[model samples]
Target chain A: MITATPRKDLLLMGIFTLAVLTMPIWLAPIGASYPDLLQRFAIFGIFAIGFNILFGLTGYLSFGHAAFLGVGSYTAVWSFKLLSMSVVPAVIFGVITSGLFAVVIGYISLRRSGIYFSILTLAFAQMSYNLAYSVLTPITNGETGLQLSLNDPRALDSLVGVTPTSGIPPTNFFGIEMSGYSGFYFCAILMIIGFYISMRIFRSPFGMMLRAVKSNSNRMSYTGLNMRPYTLTAFVISGMYAGLAGSLMAVTDPLAGAERMQWTASGEVVLMTILGGVGTLIGPVIGAGVIKYFENIFSAINENVLHGIFDFLPEILQDGAVAVLSLFVGEGWHLTLGMLFMLIVVFLPGGMVEGFTRIYSRIRNKNNKNNGEAGSVGSAEVQPGE
Target chain B: MGILEVRDVNKSFGGLKALNKVELDVEEGSVHAIIGPNGAGKSTFLNCLVGLLIPDSGSVNFNGNSLLGIKPHEINQAGVSRVFQTPEIFSDLSLLDNVVIPTLASRDGAFKLNGWKRADQDSEIIVRAEHMLEDVGLIDKRNMHAGSLSRGDKRRLELAMCLVQNPKLLLLDEPTAGMSRADTNNTIDLLKRIGERGITKVIIEHDMHVVFSLADKVSVMAQGTVIAEGSPEGIKGDPRVQEAYLGGAHL
Candidate 1:
């Protein structure tokens, strides 16, 4: 089995659901309880989970996933501008459009594997980014971004006899506005659904085929299994997940920028996946939260904050400590992230999941020793693959 | 008529001719061995039959149907399985999964979007895979990663992977290349047991002991062409076989 047993999986799901729903309460101590950043954690978590399906299962490193995310954002915004302010239609349109986009890109890119496949995806994404910025100006609204306007005819809203308001109407689900706590909950529920789907895929026969593709694709063909369709299916599924995440971003704040399709955004998702644990179920979510936390909180640590923290030190030592530490915070927070990435890659190639597994197994081993069950310890130790 | 027919099959890589007008026929339910020196094109011929490498000009017919221009998976779906010399098992997977994959493939054809079914809970496929693993004497370690197994064990796992599909033709390239004496004997016994199931086997080997022990017929190749073909005992007495093994007047 690629994942745990049904009972264990259900238990894991329960724990995850509880933790996510109470994120606002628990994350308050870390100053991450605010709605905007909370929404981001859920949104990017969905993005990274989707990316993991293709990259982790099939070992096809895609560098253009952000293009799907951008497509979704644009689609959702267009839905808002053209159809209505309801979030349902925007999510549906966003997902379907991005899935079609994934079909085209995945079909072409999957012809090559390894570095060539990565380069092909990168090229496609870059082309999409440039097109959205320039050539597709009328459709994408160019560099300034796609946003809803009052002058445009919202046909669906008008048919429902929704009176035109002075200011722009907030995106909503029925009467509940998609902003503040409601917006975060909407994204969080979708993220949980996305996670559940990924878990099912991980345990499925198709998942086994995908893992077989990763292990030895050459042998798979001889075993009478074609890997192309499986990879393509995964690509479309993941692209739809990215689209969902993008649509959530629009629902939370109804704007779609061309910058979302940039190569850096694509690279950020890769970092999140690798940093958490490439193939583990919950690793990418953890990775996304960590990276996003760094992006928001860590970068907000300025020289003044550093000085205040070092105020108890002697005058010279205080200045010295702040000077040295400031390089890794504020505008230099990327330095901290880079070092963490390098350390994780070098020491724990399986990412943070491996680190957690080691710690967990070590604790179990120590407990067994304390209980005088040394004879069974070796056999009882859990394997990483299992 | 033979089950598999190959006529005037040829392949070239630059100036080197890997196979030159190779003609062979494999009867149903018989073991055919191709023995040769390092560069005798034995592997190349096997590759052609499985569509890994297309023959430059020839016809490869299996069960009255041509096996040309088809993908490897499609050829495999047509009932041809291959065991590579290097033992191409899915090392990252458990031994059980290594066998179950082929079983699923054999049942589901080349492609099936079977995402909803729980892979580990499939009792029928699991039973078949376990039976194959048991037949190969690896059932005890079925949950272990295939990569963690020894060289001989990996070969056994690969064989189980191929046999689980119940292929009509099994192409093995040096099945006992790096096995110990006992392991080699075990493999020979395993092959003989599998032969009773009526699966046609084409083996490429360098060991004369294995060739004589299992092959119903033997073909000796030298310089990219078959030099002689006959019963194992008759091929042993052939002079061309001697010349191919030992350089003649030039020595």
Candidate 2:
């Protein structure tokens, strides 16, 4: 009975965006030393948001999305090499190239759906990675990966007399530095834009058709709607998002590597999406932050950190605690992630969003019950007979 | 010219003939009913007409356009819409959303890229969908999920979805197969109302009461061949139809 009205959701999203923009200031005490990590968080959050547009809403789980991300990164790096060192052109090239890649992959993969469609995308991604690493070595730089080279002629830079001694010039936007704090802010702006676009798409008629296709494709087809094009559009849009994230990553770091296009990286986005909540708007962003946080912070905790935390315990217990905890941290991080994934899938199939909403509703219902009881008692005292 | 013309359509599944030299001509604004016993290829014929199944030979023409080797969506683009016997609908979407999809798709044509457009802004489509829903008496349940509707109501919702497309030919495969007496009567009345709207209808039904009540022309098929094609009264008294039904009492 609760129909989703976009106005309330949009207002909530606006507040969330405002909070995110001010988060660095709020977390300055704890996160002052980790600006790079925060930047990565925003970039990957953009990636996951784009992934969610296709996988979550349309129910098309694409395994080849990393190819788009890799393509974007490569395109951005090439833009820096050929054009100005500005991140704008690089990111635009990245997004456009990624969209092109998606159109091809989407056209083919969308012919079949479910597991077969997933496998098709996985195959395409693997092929792309292999090509980047070997076959397209001249353009992609192969195993060594594409990097900025000082020796390479940048016609625009030379003509403008803005040539740098370093092979690869640092990324900037209109003479404003794009690295460090500026880089993070740039990525954050892109993330906000990506998030807003996704929010709009989620409320659109096209979004409704995608959901209809997900719920009952046969029915939509019978209703005279061809589902293939809608699905392909979702795929391309998501690919552009992944491309944007990849482009930002390249612009922030000034390098593009074949590793970015790996199948495991593609799998990571899926994990982030599922862990957050498949269809919820903010769920992917939350999931991305959690997984990235674990990757950066949790993996950094070694045996020494474990021992330091348990220093108050007895000597015997302290040493034993560090040993046991080491089984989960550092080299055992994958095991921990695997276990967490399984637990989430088994216990909370709807993911973190559903869990939070459940708790919120329970608390609200309890408060309502208390208020009802209080009102009944007050009314009883007001009765003339009493 | 007939609104829907199926000329010499033939279909076979691995040497087993499902339909052989089947031909049909449905006039515009007429209720054409196809009735047959089990294994008479009634569903197969309907599927062929709607492009769900391709005939080995012959063409299905809708409004003068040949429907040979066309995709199902393309067939729909040609102004041929269908309602499945199972009442196929997007169960997760509301009844109003269910009607809105076909209305949008019909106007935009197949494979359009109108991203992020508001559905409410299309006043023409909204008015048509509202009118169709009103006719089907599903205006009250417009906000309810299509899946939550009763069996009879789901059928009504499916009908509304089909009607909103302004289809030149509405192919209904058993509009009232699993309904109770009251539901069946309601469906019959609904079909009568639809007939009054002046849209051509081609239905494959097993319900004799439904067929007798609404069909302007009834065709009887047995062994994938039309044994009788005439008025409902002619079909009722036809010896071949009686023989086909004699072996299959349910019909």
Candidate 3:
């Protein structure tokens, strides 16, 4: 029921674009401005945004989306090997291949719903992972993973008479190399475009139908609507988003690994979506940034860094504090992530967006009370489902 | 010939018979009421007609086409809309969205890829949805979540959802299942107000007041089959119908 005006969406888009584009400037204080981490933020943000279309809108929890990500990475690497070092062909092939893969898996997996549907997807992903790791070694390159070789036919590069160097060429957009700051910017632009498309979907009739499917599928059928195609379209779209993210991963660092398709990777995106807030347009992206920040920042903290921060304290007390905190950082960062995930799930079921809305409404209410306004109580309340 | 015809429809669940040789003929532009005591196959018959339950042996013809073996949405696309007894609506959506969905379903058929356009920007559908909300006297709450409405209001919203479809036939299962006397009367008045649309309606109800006020014809069912059919007055006084209600101990 929260009506989204064009003005409101435009305003939201403006803020989102500014925030994403200025990551290097603002996130410097938090030490997350490095191009690799920034690129991860944009790429995973796209993944989570797409994942929300199916999981948040349709309420279908897929535990196997990593398969699409894996598929996209492999397809992109293959495109780079056979076609060109330019990322355009790789990204296109990645999205298209994963979309077709989604059509097949979604058609089969969607025959079931709820836990069964999740299990079916998980099974599919695990199967794909195993195949990519061992059975499909010729294409996936098995445990060593897929990477470009110096001798491989770079069709487009050769056709353009672009001589190969001794080292494998880095991926590029036309002639602009995808590395460091340039790579981060490219991924950021694509992420913004993906976010815009997601915003349009959330405001579309098709999106309403997806929500209807989530709200009451029985009533939807009786009201003369089919639930399958709507959900399938959402699933395929989401898979394509994962594919896009995967292709970006390859673009940034021309290597496709089997680990990218692992179940844990799929679970990571789920955690990001839930941690940010499901169904909200910007929540998943925020979640993606938070998780990536934790993975990069928290894991970087070592005993020496802790000792340096606690150097002012007495020797014994400093050692005890460092020892106690060591389990929460470094290799133990997953424990911290797990704790945060549990907290978000238990207390903030609506995620960070709901928390922000609650804080915002409380501030508005206080302002209204100070102004002695009796009306406008409902005006500040925004539904998180939007 | 009636607009809807059900002949010798039989549905059984294992050892229990839910419907047995059920025959119903709903004339065009008529309000046909089926009244029965608990577990009298009223809801089952309605489900059979709408393809929710496939009758084991029977033919359900709507507008001269067989309703057997078709999907529920397909049946709905063929102009058959159903309202559940418990007021099944899109509770997470706004009241306006609750109405708008059905209109979109009717306009676009079962599935459409209209993602390029904004749903709220479609002035035609938005205007029609607002009009429906106004008709149900809930235009002020159009922005409120459907889940937040009171019980009586949810029922009204459900009716608006069905009515917006402009279906050829409307099947209602206990349109007034739980309500105060005042709310029940309001529903009766609302049904009468919409009677001008002349949409054929098959309503299964236990409320006799609702039956007498709206039904052009009444069918009384007992056990798993219809025992008597006539005008509401004729069916009310029929000894066989009375026996079915009270086991012949009185009346």
The DockQ values of the predictions, listed in order, are 0.69, 0.35, 0.77
> Candidate 1's residue-wise lDDT over B1-251, tens digit each?
99899889899999999999888889999999999888999999999988899889989999999999999999999999999999999998888889999999999888888887788789999999999999999999887778889999999999999999999999999999999999999999999999999999999998888999999999888878888999999988788887886554221
TM-score for every candidate vs. truth? 0.98, 0.92, 0.98
Weakest 10 consecutive residues of candidate 3 chain A by summed lDDT: A375-384
User: Which ranges of candidate 1 are over 4 A from the true structure?
Assistant: A1-3, A375-386, B247-251
Tell me the deviation in Å of residue A310 in model 1. 1.9
lDDT of 2 by residue, A121-164 (tens): 99999999999999899999999999987876666767799978
lDDT of 3: 0.92
lDDT of each: 0.91, 0.84, 0.92
Q: Which prediction has the highest DockQ against the true structure? A: 3
**Clash-forming residue pairs, model 1:** none
Per-residue lDDT for A1-386 in model 3, tens only? 24589999999999999999999999999899999999999999999999999999999999999999999999999999998999999999999999999999999999999999999999999999999999899999999999999988989889999877668888999899999999999999999999999999999999999999999999999889999999999999999999999999999999999999999999999999999999889899999999999999999999999999999999999999999999999999999999998998999998888788777777777888889998465864345366
Off by over 4 Å in 3: A379-384, B249-251
Q: In lDDT terms, how accurate is model 2?
A: 0.84
